[model samples]
Target: MTSLAFLLPIALGMGLCGLAAFFWALKRGQFSDLDGAAARILIDDEEDIHP
Candidate 1:
């Protein structure tokens, strides 16, 4: 029972933090475009300069 003092709050805090981050990401358009990155990778970037 004593272990609950440490474990319960930590678990609750982590869950809340995860939910907050998910909500923040939703509000900030983090998940707006799911496919653009994959499409970008397929396109050749001619402007890139590599040594």
Candidate 2:
């Protein structure tokens, strides 16, 4: 149908936009430190301020 013709391009455009955004995040190092963040959460601060 005619609706399919219009929707197909829109879907493809959205997919391409998502791919571009993912690539941009890669270039910006967004996925570079996945493990460090998890480790940071487990780290405990030993500083005692309740003197």
Candidate 3:
């Protein structure tokens, strides 16, 4: 009973912090080019392999 009182607020606070961080990143354009990274991996720009 006493443990619940302590744990619930802690859990909610952590969840809110995570949400805030995500929004901050979003506003800073962190997720602006989501498709760019995925497409880059598919195109291999390999140079010559001369021994």
Candidate 4:
């Protein structure tokens, strides 16, 4: 009972922090190029590098 009083605000605060971080990432374009990154990894640029 007493623990809930202390822990509830902490839990809510942490959840809000996570939500804010997610929104911040959205504003920063962190999730803008999801598919491009995945496809880029499969691309081979070996010809551009000369040994």
Better of 2 and 4 by lDDT: 4
Question: Per-residue lDDT for 1-51 in model 2, tens only?
Answer: 999999999999999999999999999999999999999988877674453
lDDT by residue (tens digit), candidate 1, 1-51? 889998999999999999999999999999999999879889976778553
Order the numbered candidates by lDDT, best leading.
4, 2, 1, 3
Give the number of the best model, judged by TM-score: 3
Tens digit of lDDT per residue, candidate 4, span 9-46?
Answer: 99999999999999999999999999999999899898
lDDT of 3 by residue, 1-51 (tens): 999999999999999999999999999999999999999888856663443
* Number of the top-ranking candidate, with lDDT as the measure: 4
TM-score to true structure, per model: 0.81, 0.82, 0.85, 0.84
Window of ten residues with lowest summed lDDT in model 1:
42-51
**Which is the winner by lDDT between candidate 3 and candidate 4?**
4
Clashes of each: 0, 0, 0, 0
- The lDDT for every candidate, in the order shown, is 0.93, 0.94, 0.93, 0.97
lDDT: worst 10-residue window of model 3: 42-51
